[model samples]
Target chain A: MDFSQIIPSLPSLWDGMKLTLQLLLLAVAGGIALGTVLALARMSNSALLSGFAKAYVNYFRSIPLLLVITWFYLAVPMILNWITGEFVAVGAFTSCLVAFVMFEAAYYCEIVRAGIQSISKGQINAAYAVGMTYSQAMRLIILPQAFRKMTPLLLQQTIILFQDTSLVYAVGLIDFLNAARARGDIMGQSHEFLIFAGAVYFVISFGASSLVKRLQKRLAV
Target chain B: MNYNWDWNIFFKSTGIGSEIYLDWFVSGLGWTIAVALMAWIIALLLGSVLGVMRTLPGKVLPAIATAYVELFRNVPLLVQLFMWYFVVPDYLPEPLQIWFKQDLNPATSAYISVVVCLALFTAARVCEQVRTGIQALPRGQSAAALAVGFSIGQTYRHVLLPQAFRIIIPPLTSEFLNIFKNSSVASLIGLMELLAQTKQTAEFSANIFEAFTLATVIYFVLNMSLMTLMSLVEKKVRIPGMMGGAK
Candidate 1:
């Protein structure tokens, strides 16, 4: 009932929010870029390229995000040491960013693939008939249209990613949730701080989702 | 890397206990399945009701259902788990708070909170699926049922829901698979699920790669089996003239 503790904790919580936002924006950008390539590779005529992309998506999709985050957190340092022949300290932020981008690419790849598929086959044929190369057709004719169609879905996924950034706490990252918990521990009001954090998360996620819904409605027309 | 690989670490004794690392994995797998199955049952049951409410011919009921879905679906699963674990106990009345916080075993309490949190969170998603399924049904079906003297409840139970549920099998399969994957979050609250076991094994044996690799394989196998099983169910339940079953 006493939410008085949340006011004093706002400064630290704002720092945590910055980390969460940073992770969200970075992962969305990186994941979408990788996902677009994977979608192209998946739909390519070359069996090897398609198979690799398919396997990558399936592997990431089959497992939980928590395990992926943990794996990157634990294995990165060892992999770095093996490469350089000395121990290396890769921070939790870097590891989590790597994990989120890689894991989310699988999902984004599916979304992008669906988006690309939604474009009519005739459009690609027309692009090729005009002497455009495969890459050129995709880059100019197909992708622009697909990207427009996918904006709402991509934004919806970003909202999901924003919620998921809280999982970086697994690797001791000072995400908003972690920062709230830390402040809670020091202030002996863990429940109040947690409630505050949950309310904040709910507000952001719900508001973004509503915006995405409106955008979807407009796009449909 | 010049690091030595110990593939046999799963067979080695933990020294502090009689069990090997393999036993830890087996037990962890058991907990994972148990939590996922229990939570899935609750989510399905609760979500079905909420979904039906949203589709029913009333504003108040649908508004309530929408509110529930929006509230539960918006919050992250981890924060919800933390709230249930840390906050719910303090808000309970005096004797119940003591019972939850003190009288009950820590792991048991953690298990209960995780299951409840996950079920509520997932129920919101399931509600959407069910609502979509119900709404997707042709309006003629409801009208015909009503014209034939069927009550609203009877129409849903006999005519609407049966067809709607059949139509949504594919999406429902994905949701069912998600419950298993989402159950891994229980480890965050100290439930010692498969991921937690993997972390412990890595710490104990220092075979970080081996531990995670094995856990990943196990999860993959588990999901593959579920996918196969659900597909079989989907095939069996498919209505001949319906969406996926159409020739």
Candidate 2:
């Protein structure tokens, strides 16, 4: 009901928003880079490569992101100790970053695979006829076209990623939602701060998705 | 690190009320299934109505429906859950507020908030699926129903919805599976769902790998079995020569 509490809390909430944007950007970059490799591996002729890629995608897709975040949170320090023979402390942000990137890569791999498959096979053949090596053909010809076709979908996934970054709260990360709730706990206006946070999330995600829709429409032609 | 790998932790007691770790997982599974199944019913029903509303022959109703979908779809489910849990109770009337905050069991309150939040969030997605299913039908089907003197309502009831629901079985099945996964979010608010139970077990026993691995396998088997069951339903109801039903 009361909206006045939100103004005083904007500073903390902005810090939270920055952290969210950081996770979103890093995850998108890492996920797409890893996903591109997985997609290529899945599409390659070797059965072992494709089989590994398939299993990776299927396993991640079947589980929830919250579980993945929790798993990484618990596993990273132990895995680090195994490598270094000493216990290492990893921050919540770092663990969540690894979790998001790994989890999102599986989804992006499927999207990128579909995008690559949409390109005509003759294009790859023509590249071969021109004496281009497979990597050269993929990097120069196939991937460029696939990226263009996949842009709208990739952006849409990024919007979803933006929303999902809020899950970092599971590990006690000071993301946007957590920041808002913290401020609310202090101000005794928990309701107002939460409603305000919800609105801010709505505006950003809804606006981004609308832009994606427009881009999808333009790309279709 | 030479970590202890005790596969028998599930059989050990938690030192409180004589309950074993396996009991935690079983109860957690029960809560997960209860929350997901209850929410799915609400989502399916409300989503279908909103889907039909968006396609109706009016500007206001469609706009309202579109706004509902966009509002629910864009916000993160966790934020929505927080709002429902921590905020919504305060806005209720005094007696209801007292009942929600003071009279109701904390676990029950958390469960109600999570179920409502998940249902609304998933309903937005289901609305789109239903809308697409309805729109994918050839226009002639609806027009022909009207031509035969069927009202719009009757046409939807008798002709359109049955077909639309049939075509969307595959996508709807995915949504159904997603509800189970999304139900895990309930844990963040202190509901002892599967993920929460897994975390508790890991911390209590210090067998992190075994705990998470078991939860992961449970989720995988649950999803795979649901997919198999839905595919069987998809086959049983497939209309010959229909778009998705075609081999």
Candidate 3:
């Protein structure tokens, strides 16, 4: 509502954006790696590995992100301190990163599971016929193909993750959405806060959507 | 082997009985389920109408639909709720302002605002999914229905929605989970949902681990149960002929 005041507070907004970007990058990168492992484990032929992976994803996936973040940032450290020397509690950004990784990994595991499961089973057999080890067959044949189909799913998940960075605000991280709130507080203008923050989210999501379309085009799908 | 896990302290702070921490945890779980159920119902009803309208032939309607989706879909529900709770009230008429100030409780208003914001936001996603499901049906079914002189309403009722819902059930369940998870954001505005309760409990008991752990478990149980129910619904709605279309 107060343009004059908000314009001057852009630097604070930028700070929030920095936090948002770092959190997203960490969560997405870590989540994708952790998720891939979780996915493979879930899909593993070994019952123990599959059950472990399934439990990991199921437990994390079922919980809300805020609850998880609060737990890690608050509880885990307290428990650690109770036993021994002071624990290295993660900063707000890192706390969200860890929680989002666990949460997003659960989802990514499923996405990867769907993609991996959807691949024709006989492709592995065909790869095996060529004297490929199971690992070799998976690495060379099944996954590359699965990766193609996962493009859209991956894009969708990324967008959802981006939006979820907003939740990190509750943990006291000045994310993009949080920046808007700060702006509102400083300027006493909620409209400016929401409008700018909403625009930031929209840009990120729309950008991801376009990237997906580009990937589809390049893949000629 | 030096890791001494003190189960007793955690048990005392977090376990059952007149423990304030445990009360917060239980109440938090109750709030999460309450808001999710309330928001899901509103979204489903509103979204179904919009979804049905999307398929109807009208230039004006599609634009309206597009605008509706774009407005809600593009923004974070948190921001929407924030605006609804904080900014929108100021713009209301004078009597409405007095009513909001004197008659309405901020806490209840916050929940109602959250319900409205979450419902509209989620309804956009549901509308798209439903519309996709409905449209993905082979063109022939609707064509055949029309050939038999089935009215548009009749065709939608008898021929389209039933099959579309069958195909959309799996994704629909996922949306249900997503919305349920999202409702936690209402905590920011002092809606004492699960997440907020965790914060309050942790502050009071200084047992953040147990308090939040309980909330997390409750969320896990709630979502898992919801997922199971949804998948069951998915199975029940599995029409044999609709297999080819669903994702």
Candidate rank order under DockQ: 2, 1, 3
How are the candidates ranked when ordered by lDDT, highest leading?
2, 1, 3
Which of 1 and 2 is ahead in DockQ? 2
Interface RMSD of each: 0.9, 0.7, 2.6
Better of 1 and 3 by TM-score: 1
lDDT tens digits, residues B1-247, model 3?
A: 2343333433455454657455666776777777788888988888887888888897888778867876787676777887787778778899987787568877778777788888888899899988998999999999999999999999999999888888888888888998888888889888898788778866756655556666767777777788889877777667565575355
Clash totals for all candidate models: 0, 0, 1
> How much lDDT does each candidate structure score?
0.92, 0.93, 0.79
User: How many clashes (backbone atoms < 3 Å, residues ≥3 apart in a chain or on different chains) does model 1 have?
Assistant: 0
- Badly placed stretches (over 4 Å) of model 1 are none
- Candidate 3 collision pairs: A75-B209
Give the Å error, residue A195, model 1.
0.8
DockQ scores for all predicted structures:
0.86, 0.88, 0.51
User: In order of the candidates, what TM-score does chain B achieve?
Assistant: 0.97, 0.96, 0.88
Fnat of each candidate = 0.85, 0.84, 0.67
Please provide TM-scores, in order, for all candidate models, with all chains considered together: 0.98, 0.98, 0.88
User: What would you estimate as the lDDT of candidate 1?
Assistant: 0.92
